[model samples]
Target: MWDRLATDGLAILVIMCLIELIVPSRAKGPVMWGFNLVFSLMLFASTLYYAHFGSVPTYTALRELHQVPQIKGSVESLIEPEYFLFFIDLLVLAILWGVTLSKPKSMRLGRRPVWKIGVAAAGVVSLILSGWYIHNGGKIENEIVQAENLGFLDYQVAAVLKENRQNDEITDGNLGKTKSEVKKLQATFAYKDASSGKGNLQYFGAAKGKNLIIIQMEAFQNFPLHLSLNGQELTPVLNKLAAEGLYFPNFYQQIGQGNTSDAEFMSNTSIYPTGTIAMSTGYGDRELPSLPRLLEKYNYESSTFHVNDVSFWDRSKMYPALNFTHYYDKPSYTNDHFNAFGASDEELYRVGVEKLSELHKQNKPFYAQFVTASSHAPFNVPKDRQRITLPDSLQGTELGDYLTAINYTDYAIGTLVERLKQNGMWDDTALVAYGDHFGILPKLASEEFISSELGIKYNDQVSRYNIPLLIHIPGQSSGKVVERVGGQLDILPTVANIMGVSLAKEGFTAFGHDLLNVDHNIFGMRYYLPTGSFFNDDVLFVPGKGFDDGTAISLKTYEPVTDITKYRADYDYILKLMKLSDAYVKQLPKRGP
Candidate 1:
């Protein structure tokens, strides 16, 4: 309890000092008290955030406060009665101040600079202690563990320091050297058999000259594709698509602070998000090597469609950085009041299909991306939009709302397919659909609750991060379910292979491999999970202090695995790979202003 108080109270104390410095000496007492009360309330808010995200928010997360207004329903639902206790001191101080106001002016104590000196001194001491704690903590790999060791204030300080160090490392590094290191590391891994006479480039250029359409679904998970709720299919359209395409059941999300946008970055560039900040916000000025640039060589026009404002998550800079030829944002679609994003997935697809069809009519091959937002958080669907009926037990619950939203999203895809078919583009298009990240917050959606309700076992982190990846090639009618473990980082190479684009030949550096050809795969994730954590074919391993003290859980069984000795190679490999990815991305030339 004392540790909790010390760690949580630091923010409150810092706020108090700031108030002391700003307010008049005469009003310091009541003002400080009121400010401390507000700080306490913020602490409660942070706790709620931690409970939902399984990590503490740093200073960078504060930049997203402007987004709260858009997600007010979800934000409000996180508040609980216990958070009100933070206001108790404010209530007492208010009464005391009222009573003192009634007393004579002579009865009040005179202001002293000594009190200010003491507060300033305490603040300095707090800073010193925080720095000491962070220094002793060693590496800033796992943010949750770092925060636990150094407290929130110190963790924020450590984050800033670590980010600075990373920037310096990137600025000093050579891209050529990083690429060589990547090549050597990849060569060591036996991705394919050379001695057996099987070419490493199997299925390379399988569907050349095909128009590409990628749908990055928001907060969609793989579990819904195969699961039924109350005898009703949750994602019927996705299920049908899975039946007609290449389905990767073991695919995971590799997003960092950027979330959906990070997924976009990885899927396009196969590079790792720095994990300290949103990739879109941090590296959007870099001349990124991406699919759009690669496709442009083949005379393919690249465009992306999203219902949100182009500036959200700084995508305005990101799209240009990725070298997309065109983009359709909020102004391109009709307002359907679907959610905070304003337009429904159906409308987004309508605009996308029409635009792509126009490009096809001009005899131009296009690479079009559709970012779906109808199934975004709070999972609220308009009455007319909802296509699924929930059982009485889940009527107003988050689970029920999620299913309804997902069902509507699935229904919308059918409309997109119909439009594509009507435009005579269905037979020649190569379609890929995958989720940006996980949706369910573990605090509200417990493992037992999900297992019992959905009749399927769910591991908090493993299953939560697991998302669907379905790629439908033109002229293919039968589906293939590949059991290889993969992440968003693998999407580029995988799609490139099917589209007959050779990354190696183009001198493109990708941190991920082709999920279609690779027999075994491993990917690292550092956003919701710790930096050292990695998922292989067997288990998800998370480090404690270091790899020696780490823990592993079986992906298939969702149970704890005691012996993690076999996964040491994967841990080391993934760490090296992610470091190389960071270096490679940072070394890229900055885009012109």
Candidate 2:
């Protein structure tokens, strides 16, 4: 506490001292007070961001503040009464200022020569101290530790400095060279032999020449796929689909600050999100190589559907950048007031199928992307729209609210499936469904709370991030559960494999591999987890400072792994892969107007 206090106080003192030197004596107090008030709000925002995103937010996060009103339910739920303490000082200041206005008394701090000299000396010392803290903390690769060592305010400054230094180290050029380097890197790294039991070409061309419909579900996780609550099945529609489709139990989310949109970007592009900014806002100017773009060669028309405005998260810019033919958002759907995002998942799919039916009539093979919103955070499904009933014991609980919301979302999917089958499109469509990210927050549903309530073991890190990835190629009879560990980045490659699109022949560069074909897979995660964190087949590795100070947990057992010596190369390889992904995306050519 003292270290953080000293770090925060020193940065404020340096700024205040500088303001005093420039401003008139009478104005100094008021100016410094106003600046401090703004600074306090920044700290409060950072705290709240950490509470929501589980990461120390950078200045880039401020760009997304306009979205707070759209997600008001989730934002309001994040606020605790104690969070208002940040403004208590301002209230006291306001009261004192009102009393002073009656008396007309002035407060000055820079008039005296001695006071000015002391202030300058104090500023120099604070500047030196804060600089030392930033320099030390800035070198740490793990952002969580970096935020701890350097306080919130200084951490932002360090982030800027680090980014500038990195920017200076590289020069932008063709993505071809980067792709070549990526392929060479993958070739050198030792991948686990992936072809002992299954056929080397299993599932290839399984859904060839089929219409593609990818459903990105909101806040969906894997645990509920086959689970029950109070004698009620949580997700019957999804359970049925899982029993008949391809299920990936070891898949996880790889979203950045953009949350849902980031998942969409990574799944389509097979590229890592930089974890510093929303990919839609940051890289939407670039022409992204995506599943839509790949299928366009085969005369497929790609269209995306969401119930919100395209302006949210700048999807207006992203859809075009991804070479999508059409995007149906906001005005395209009927608002049933299902959640803060406006329409229910049922409405989203209903509009999706309606639009897709027109393409089917034209004999066009379409790629339809449906983004669901009914199960968004602060999961409050309207009582009337709810599909499942909760016993009195679980009524108002966070877990209970979540189950209700997802139950409604699942029931909505049954509508889409029936409508597709009615249109004679079910057998001709490649339906891929996956969660955008983790739903349950740690504060509301910790391991102990979940175990007591659900009578199941839950690892906050392992199980919390594990999301479901199911792919249904219409003609397949029985479901196959693939145990390969994968992230959102692998979605495009896996889908491409199923659809018989040869990425190699197309010269398409993908950072992720075919989950079905890869012998052993290891993928990195950041933003939520630290930079060095990764999940391979056996364990999830999270670094504190670096490799030596990191911890690993068994993905299968959810128990701590003591010795991490063998995992060092996987850590080093993921870092290199992500760095290449960052550089590759950064160098992508801007879309022409």
Candidate 3:
């Protein structure tokens, strides 16, 4: 904390000196007090944000602040008693303020010409020191490390400067040229098998001409798939689905600031979230090349269902951007007393089945997406609504509540499956259900705490980011536990492969590869992890300022890898790939208003 003092301290000093030089002597106290309060509040928010998201809060984060009221339960859950210590200094300040108010007159620190000159010089000196601190840390692609090195206030400023620099790069990139460069670089990675000299024809046409149904489960994790709480299976329905489908146990979420919405964006578009902002909020105006758009050529009518308002997370714009033929939101579903755009996952699927069954009767193939919210943060489900019985250890605990919500979510999907079968749409449809992101935040349930409770070796980041990806193609009898390391970005290409849709033939530019065909794969992640952090077939590698001080842990074994020099090339490749992805998405043509 002391080492970080240079950045924040210098910044505060500059501000204090500036106020002294500019403000009236009588009003100085109130102004400084207000500044202090704002500073403290920002620090407090940053702390809680780090606790919840495991990333430093930047100015970009403020754009999502408007979303806080909608997720008030989640925000409240993130707060702790100890976090109020950030405002302890304010207690004394407030008391002093009251005493000063009660007094007959206020004392003034007389400011002469020499004193003003000294204050100005001090401000200039402190400003330079703050800039120096920012300069030292700004080059770091790792946000967490940069926050530690530059302190919180300076880090925000550094982020803006870095963002501008990256913007310049984005502005300079050409769409056609970038698409070519992406393909050229991707060929070097060789996603398809060299031995077969073909695309993943194994799964090609596997579910061709079938309707598509994708369930974007909320805050669900991979660990609960085959696990039991006491004697009860936590997610029996999902376990059954995993048994019947191809499940990617090594899959991780690639969501950014938009979280669930970002998962949808990546799954549909095969584009990076840019990590700095929510893709839906930022690029909802662009005409995205998506699964819905791709399937349209094959005569598949696309629709999406969410229990929340379409305006939430700007999904109203994103659905159009993705070129969905239809969408169902709040008014389309029955409200079950879920407030502030929250809904039971069961109701969400119930409506999805009802609407899609109509399309089934019409004999039209369709692509339908359902984004669930029942298991969102601070997972709450009435006891009557819960599916699995919890043990004494988990009962009433956040972990317990989370498990119950996940179980209910899985059960809801089971209803969707049964309804599809009853509606005669099951055998002709490709069913896919995957978690949008991990449910359990570390602050509520620490790795050690969860490991002890569940009797499993739970890694904080590795297991936390590990979301389940299951694809159930019609007529496939048994399940295959795919061992390939994949992210949410891989969903589109993988689904396309199963449905026999060739993105290359359509001239579509995709940053992600077909997980089924990739013998070797590497993908970058940011917003949650540091910018240059990537997961390869072997390990999850995270860089320090650059690749030299980076660390690696085996993806399979969850053990640290000491010698990471060999993985440096993979790190470099992923960095370039993500940058190109960011550039490509920015270059996309805007939709006609």
Please list the residue runs of candidate 1 whose C-alpha ends up more than 4 Å from where it truly belongs after superposition: 7-24, 30-38, 92-127, 138-140, 188-190, 193-200
What would the TM-score be for candidate 3 when compared with the true structure? 0.96
Candidate 3 regions exceeding 4 Å error are 94-107, 338-341
Clashing pairs in 3: none
Quote the lDDT for 508 in model 3.
Answer: 84
TM-score-better candidate, 1 vs 2:
2
Q: How many pairs collide in each candidate, listed in order?
A: 1, 1, 0
Candidate order, lDDT descending: 2, 3, 1
Question: With candidate 3 superimposed using the best TM-score fit, by how many Å does residue 383's alpha carbon deviate from the native?
Answer: 1.4
Single out the weakest 10-residue window by summed lDDT for candidate 3. Answer: 103-112
lDDT per residue for candidate 1 within 1-593, as digits (tens), equals 35755754665566667676677767877676766676676678788777666667887877666656766777777777887786787778778878877878666543456766888887777666656677876485677777787776667778888878877987887989889999999877666656645555655776799899999998898888977877888888888888988899999998987788889998899999978678998899999999999999999999999999988888998999999999999999899888877999999998999899999999899999889999998898999888878898888888878878888888888899899999999988988999999888877778788778888878888889999999888888698888989999999999999999988789999989999888777889887888889988889998887788899999998889999998888888888888888889888999887
Flag the better candidate by lDDT, 1 or 3.
Answer: 3
Whole-model lDDT, model 1: 0.84
Question: Any residue pairs clashing in model 2, and if so which?
Answer: 194-519
The per-prediction CA RMSD against the true structure, in angstroms, equals 2.9, 2.2, 2.1
| Per-residue lDDT of model 2, residues 401-498, tens digit only | 98888888889988999999999999999899999999999888777887778878888999999999999888888999898999998999999999
